[model samples]
Target: MLEQKHMALLEEAERRAIAPTDNIRACFELLALTGAIDRDCAVRLARHRLSEGKFVLLFLLHDKPDGLSPHELAERAGVTRATITGLLDGLERDGFIARRGGLEDRRKIAVALTEVGRQMARELFSEHTQWVASLFEGFTADERKTLHELLQRIWRNLDAGKQQTGQTADARA
Candidate 1:
């Protein structure tokens, strides 16, 4: 099985004096699993002619009917304004979105989904939901809840590490 292969690799690593502690093995496995998941998700999105950024922008605009400014979209999407501009350009070229003057302020531009875009989002949304649900098909409801809690704990640990690093840097400064 896959688990046996992983165990054999870990054993080889340990035999080679590669310092394969339990924590190190756990971290390696987690990173490998997440990297594979990310790659698979990207492949799925590409089937619809969407990069992750484009897909995110599409859904964000889909949720916000009125529209959002380039700056706002960049912040919401966790990308740079320049990156957002490139995505918007591609979406507009494909006729999936439109950039128009804001209703409240004519000078300000807001991006909105066109009818075509809305229709695509609706279809993609359903497919995406099923795809995500499939990822958890092996887990029971309680197992899913436990997994969520454990992931949250890991996130908190990462956040705490970041804060500690910042404090150390500030102290050195």
Candidate 2:
């Protein structure tokens, strides 16, 4: 009762459906692929955010309105305070960010992006949008929509599974 194309797609989906070890490997592989892409993009963008700075800032700011101190940023980013110190220096020098002395504790330095930095962040975000658009360029609108929904569901299921198991899906790896 199914069309040939539909049957073929179903078969392919079955073939590629997340299996035991493949799930962990696939996640790691995806991270690796993204790492490679980020490495290349860092050079192309000449931006630290494209490389590592943005991720550090994002994680720190995710739960707080005020940005993280340099020490906090370095800790979250898994770098030394000295490294963050230099990174902040470069960022501030480029007019991409501004730092303020802590209100109650002047010893602490709070870091945040300036207007120019936010604009750069917007531009970086657009780069991702463009990349995603190009990735699905061959897909129809319906297919793209379906794929997005399916991926979201898969991610949710994976997170739920991890929570329940208390072990990484890495056992399958």
Candidate 3:
């Protein structure tokens, strides 16, 4: 837990040394400097292995082990169902996924990663994770924890702001 004095010091540092707008700009700058945008583009390029169809499915599957339906993918990725459908179609065409009739009934189609897809997802996820980890090699564990907690709280405040602006759903939507 943070003491009030520590919180005040952190707040004072942000107020005096880092304007909110400037901090946001710096974040973008750091992303660019560290080539996170480039990394994302590389991942996007790997999609061309099968029109990024398999890659997106693999990433989503790995992100949610229980698995995600095409509709869930669209919501999580902030994409349209048609887009997810297209991606799934291409992935299925490439043998990275398979569709099964719903267990209890035969009406719904559920998708799952094929073994090949799982292997590919694991490899890509590991590669990207290593790259991200290398970026913070200088931070100690305690610093990392502190940063994580502060960022989480800040994120909540930002979410609250979005709610206030009607950008986020009401009732924690």
Candidate 4:
């Protein structure tokens, strides 16, 4: 009825008996939209020889000159240690990242981007920024701001729920 793919999908989902509650329907819509955005972005990055996780790691490291530990990267990426380790390995192999001895202990490893990594990160991040901007070209500045605030609020609510359930609420992903 809304003449939108997301709304149409939600309607179809409801017809198929996927919990008709507004909250659940909203969740489905968000998931559909997010998944499509993520998929398209991933393909775009893949053409540039990057994975979604690696792109995220590069951006994260770009913000922190001091770098982060593997544990920290895992937490920030909302991924498992094994997954982070694999991503690091691939990036490192491509000369995009390097692991050095931690300051506290020789046995501890500190993960960071190499010089080449920094250059690539900057280039890739610029492209990524432009690509994402194009997706929201129709949105006014106020609309974009409102969308961000609403999403942030949703994240905070989910994080609060997690905390209430005695779970660690490392909410950024």
- lDDT string for model 1 (1-173, tens) is 13556778777878887774676578667877887778888999888778889988889999888899999999999999899999999899988899999999999999999998898888888988898899899899999999899876675457475575554544545
lDDT of 3 by residue, 1-173 (tens): 34455456557867778656456554555445546555665675565465444456678776454456678778876779989988888778877778777566567767788887787778777766786687689999999999889766665667676665566556555
Candidate 4 — which residues are off by over 4 angstroms?
Answer: 1-31, 63-66, 145-173
lDDT of each candidate versus the true structure: 0.85, 0.66, 0.68, 0.84
Residue 68 in candidate 2, Cα distance off native in Å: 2.1
Model number with the top lDDT: 1
lDDT-best of 1 and 3: 1
Return the TM-score for each candidate structure: 0.78, 0.49, 0.55, 0.66
Write the residue-wise lDDT of candidate 2 on 42-121 in tens digits.
67556443445653454454444456788788888888888888877877777777888877788888887777776666
Show the colliding residue pairs in model 4: none
Residue 126 alpha-carbon offset, candidate 2, angstroms: 2.4
**The CA-based lDDT of model 3 is what?**
0.68
Q: List the candidate numbers ranked by lDDT, top first.
A: 1, 4, 3, 2
Clashing pairs in 2: none
Query: Candidate 4: global Cα-lDDT?
Result: 0.84
What are the per-residue Cα lDDT tens digits for candidate 4 across 15-125? 888666587666766787788888899899888678999989998898777679999999999999999999999999989888998887889888889999899899988
> How many clashes in each structure?
0, 0, 1, 0
Which consecutive 10 residues in model 3 have the weakest lDDT in total? 1-10
